[model samples]
Target chain A: MSNLFANQAPLLRTKTAPAAAALIASAGIIYGLVLCCINSLETFAVSFLAVLLAAILALWTFVRMAVKENDRGLLVTGAACMTAIIIVTVMPEGLPASFHVYRSFVAAALIIGLCVATLCSAVYRLLGSTPVAFDNSRYPILILPIVIALISYGMILFVLCLNGLPQISWQLISTPYDPANAALRGILNDILGTFMLMLLTSIISLPVGVGAGIYMSEYGGRIAGIIRFSTMLLRAMPVVVLGLAAYGVARMAYDTAWQGILAPDPTIMIGRGTFLLASAFLSLLVIPVITRATEEGLRSLPRDLREGSLAVGATEGYTLLHVLLPWSLPNILTGLLLGCAEVAGNVTVIVLLCGFGNYGVTPFTEATSLAHFIYKVMFADRSFRMSMGNYVYAVSVILLIITLGLTIVYLVLRNKFAERYRAH
Target chain B: MPATVEIKHLSVSYNGTNVVKDVSFEMPAGKVTAIIGPSGCGKTTLLRSINRLSELTKNCRVQGEIMVDGENVLKMDTVLLRRKVGMVFQQPNPFPKSIKENVLYGIKAAKIKTDHSDIVKSSLQKAVLWEELEHRLNESALNLSIGQQQRLCVARSLAITPEVILMDEPASALDPVSTLKLEESIQSMKGDVTLVIVTHNMQQAKRVADYTAFIYRGELIECNETEKIFANPDRSETRDYLEGKFS
Candidate 1:
C-alpha cells in the first residue's frame, strides 16, 4: 500500500499540496475576517488614516532618498489607501458631518479647490523627480480615465438638467432633507456617487496596479519572490476594513450634528447616516482585483514581445503604452470588470457602517444604488408579506443584463482595437 | 539605401551579470551584415544595441555608444528611432489585428493622414503580398500561414519606411520554399534599406550576407567582407565554426 501510494504520488503532484495549503490558509483568513466583522469590533477611522498618512509620508521619503519610485510604490499606495479607507469606515458614528467630509460630485468639484491645490503641488514635486526626461508622450493613457469622469459627470449633469433638479448645494450639505423628498434624493445621490467613485480611485488604481503588474512580470523575473509575496498579502485584505477607514477619518470632523423635529437632532448626514459610508467602504473591497489584474496584465506578456518592442528603440514607457498595454488592455479591463462586479455585490460594510435601517437612509432616495435597493427590499418588513415588492426577479435580471451588456461592449471594443492592428 | 552601424566599447550586463562584454564592430553601407556564432554569443545583443533596444530591459545596463548615421541612437527617443530602425523578430509576432491595420500601424501612429488606399497598396506591393492579399486585407493576420505572416511582418516593418532593417533569424521557422521566398524578398529589399541579420545557417549567411561578423561568447571574433571571412578567415574559431568543428 505504501509503495502503491508512493508511486501514485507522482500523478497527484507536489503542486497540489501547496495549493491545498493555500486554500486552507485563505479560508482561515476569510473566516477570521468574517469573525471579526461579526463580532462588531469597532474600528476607528482616525487611527488607520493616521497610520496610512504616516506610512505614505515615510514611504515617499524612503522612495525619494533610497528606492527611487521603486516597484513597491504600488503596494504602498494600495495598502495606505485601503487602510485609511477601512479604518475610517468600520468604526465611525459621526463619519461625514463631524469630520468635515464633503462628498464631491461634479458640482462639489468647485469646492475641491483645496484638493486641486494639493494635487498641483504634488504634480510639481513629481515633475521635480526626473527633470530632464521629457518623455511623457504616453501621458494620453492617463487621459482615458478622464473620459470615464467626463462621461459620468456629463451624464449626471445632463440628467439633472433634463429633470430640472436644481442641486441644493448649501441646503443639502447642512440641512436635514424633508422626509417626503429623501427617497428620490437618495437614489439620485447613490448612482451619481458610485459613478464618481468608480471614475476616480477605482479607475486610477486599475492602470497603476495593472501597469505595475505588467512591469513586474516583464522585469520581476524568478528573483521577485518578495514582490509576489507582498502582492498576495495586499490582495488578501478585506474590503469592509478599507472602506471603514476612508469614511471614518476623513469625514469625522465634518459630520453634521443633527436635531430631530420630534426630538433632539442626531449628528450625521441631513437625514441619511450610513448609506454614504457604505458606498465608500465598497470601494475599499474592490482593490485586490485591480492590483492583481494589473499584475497579471504585465506578467502575461511574452518576453519576446517586450524584446521586440525595445529592439525597435521604444523606451520603457513607450513600449508599455504602445505594445504591452494595448495587448494587456483586455486583461486590465477584466480586472476592473471583476473588481466592479465584486464591489457591486457587497452589502456587509454598508450594513455595518452606513445606515441601512428603519431610522437611516432609504434606497428609495435618489442617492441609493440598485444593490442597496435590492438589500432594502430583501431585508425590509412588509405587511405580513416578504417586505420587498414583487420586482425582485426583474431587478436581478436587470443586474445580470447590465453586466452582460458591459461585457459585450468591452469584448467588441477589444476586437476592434485588435482588428485595427492585425497585419495581412 | 546605404547605411553604416558603428559600435564602440559596448558592454551590457543584466542584474550585474555581464552578458556582452567589450563588443565592437561596424557593418558596411548597403550590405547584409551577418553576426554568426555559437549560442549565447553577443551577436543579438550587439544588433539590439544599434537601435538602443538593449536599454529597455529593467536590469540591463549598457555602457558605450552605437552610432548610426553619425547619431547616437541611445541619446534619442527610442520610439522615433525604432520607427526609423525596423526589426523582424525570431518568431512571427503579428499584432492580434487585421492585415490592413498591421501594414498601416506605423503610418497611422505617425499621425500623418495620407490616402489609405494608396498607402495600403504600396506597402503591400513592397512586401510582395499586394496581389495575394489584395482581397484579404480585412482578414485577421493571426490566421495567415507562418511564412506569409513573417513576410507580412516584414511588409509591416517596411511600410514604416525605416532606414535600417534588422532581421533575427527571419527564416528559421520556415520550410525550404518559404526560406526561398524570404531570401527572394530580402534580395528585393537589398539596397532599399541597411540590413543587419543574425542567422545560424552558414549557407544562408553566405547566400545573403555581404559582410559577416563571427562572434563567439560575448566577443566579436572577426568581421570582414563575407568572401574574405569565408574563404581566407583570420581566426581558427571562425574556421572551426564554419567547418562544424565545434559550436
Candidate 2:
C-alpha cells in the first residue's frame, strides 16, 4: 500500500506540473504582449508577437480542452480560433488603406482578426456544449478577452471624441457659420436644421409605420404578405436609390402646374429639396425599419392573448388599439429610436434630395442635417476641410452621444416592458 | 328553465374536412353541461360553434343554426354574439395586463359606462378570486399561478355579463389541487350563468355537470342528466366510455 501511494503521488504531480508550467508560460507571454503594446513598438513587431501569442493561446486552450475537459464546446471554439488565425495570416494585400494611416492595412487587419477570433471562442465557450447551457464556470476566463476588446474599442472612440472636444466651444455651437473665415464658423444652423428634420421625419414615420405594422399582422391577408415582402425588399434597398426616387418625385412636384396654383406667389417652389420633402423621403427609409419591428413585436405575442381579447367582445380595432399596441409599446419605441438613429447617421438621401449647401430650420425651406454637413465639409468644401475637420468630428461625437442615449433608453424600457408583458 | 342554447344540425368543417358533423343539443339556462370525449372527437368544435368562434379559423365552414336566447348566433353580429356568449380557452390565457384591467377589459370593450371598481369586485367575487386578489388589483395578471390565471379569465368573461360561458377543458392545464379549486369555482357559478364545458376528466364531468354529453368521432352518441349517464348509460359506446374501455 505504501509503494502504491508513492507511485500515484508522483504520477499526479507529473500530470499537474506540466499544466502549471504551460499556464505560467501563457501568462508571461500575455504580459509581454501588453508591455509591447504600451511601449508603442513597430507595427510589424507588434503584429508578429500578436500572431505568436494567438497561436500559443490557441494551442494551450485546445490542449486543455482535449486533455483535461474533453468538452464539445471546446471543439467548436478551437475550430473558430483556428479559422480566424488562418484568415488573418492569409489576408490578401492591396486593399485600399483608407482607414489605417498609422500602420499597414494588413497588420491592422491581422490584429482585428485576432481580436474577433478570441471573441468568437469566448462566446462559444460561454454558450457551452450539446444542450446549450450557459456555463458560468468558464465565465471569467472566456469573458475577459471579450470585455478587453470591447473596452479597447470604446477607449479608442473616446480618445477620438476627446481630441475633437477642444475644437468645440460655446462660440462654435451658438453662432452661425462665418464662411469668410472658416475658423469662426459654427454648426448652429446645421444643428437646428438637423433636429427639425429629425422631428419632421419622426412625426411622418411613426404613426404610419406602426399602423402599417398592425395592419400587416392583424387584418392583412394576401395583401399583407405582399406588403411584408415589399417592406423587406425596401429595407434592403440602397439609401442612394431611395434618395434618387425622392429627388425625382420632388422635381416632378416642383414642375407641376398645381404647385403654381396652390402658391399665391407662383415663383416659390413647394417640393424641390424642401425640409418637408427631405423629411418625407427620410420617412420612406425609416418606415420599413419601424414596420418590421412592430410586426416582430406583434408576432411575438401569444395567439391566446389575441383570442382572449376577441372573446371578450373587443372589436378588432379596439383590441389592436388597446391591447396589442400597449403590449408592444416597448418594441415599437425601440424601433422608433433605432429609426431615429438611422436618420441621424444618414447623409446620402439628404445630400441628394436636400443639397448640402442648404441650411435652414423651417419645413418650407431646404435644410442641411448634421451628417450632410459633415459630408459637405469633408468632400465638397476643400477650403474648409482642414479647418473644420475637428469640428466635423465634434458634430459626429454629438450625434453619436444622442444615438447612444436613445439606445440606452430603448434598452431600459425594453427590459421593463418585457418583464411586464412576459408570457407565462 | 328555458333552453339557453339550441344547436340544431350544426356541422363545422375546416378546409373541406368535416370536424363536427350534423349535431343537435339543447342546453338549459343556469346549468352546467359537460361535453366529454376522447381527444379529437369534435367536442371542442361543437362548443366553439355556439359562440361562432369556429369561424375564426381559415377556410372553416359552419352549417345550420346555433340559437342562443332565441337569436341565431350565426345571424347575429360576431362582436355582439361574443359579448353575449363569453368563452374560456383550454390554456389559462390572461391578457398581459393588470388584474383590475383584465376584469375591466370586457366592460370597456363593450363600451359600457358603469362603476368600474364595483364590476371588477363583483366579477372577481364570482370567480372566487376577489378574496385572494383584492389587495393586488393593480398587479400584473400574468404574475398569478396558472390556476389563478384561469380564474381571472373567468372573472374577465363575467365582467361582460355574458348569458352563457363556455369553457374548453379549463382545468386541463392545472394541477390536481388547482383543478379542484377550479371545479369548485365552476360549481359556485351554477344558477347565475349557463356553462357548457368540454372536459376529458370523467370524474370532473360527474362532479360539476348537471347534464353530460358524450361525443364520438364527430357525432353525438348520448346526452342526459349526469347521474343517469354515469349510472346506467343507454348506449354500449357510452357504457364502454364510462368503463374506460377506450380512451
Computed on alpha carbons, the lDDT of every model, listed in order, comes to: 0.59, 0.75
For all predictions in the order shown, the interface RMSD in Å is 4.5, 1.2
lDDT of 2 by residue, A324-347 (tens): 887788878888887888788888
Residue pairs of candidate 2 with colliding backbone atoms: none
Per-residue lDDT tens digits of candidate 1, residues A360-380? Answer: 233222133445546666664
- Cα RMSD for candidates in order: 21.9, 6.4
- CA shift at B183, candidate 2, in angstroms? 2.5
Worst 10 residues of 2 chain B by lDDT: B1-10
Candidate 2 DockQ vs. native: 0.73
DockQ, every prediction: 0.22, 0.73
Model 2 segments beyond 4 Å from truth?
Answer: A1-152, A178-184, A248-272, A353-360, A382-387, B1-3
| Candidate 1 TM-score to native | 0.60
Stretches of candidate 1 off by over 4 Å are: A1-278, A310-322, A352-424, B15-18, B113-116
Candidate with maximal lDDT: 2
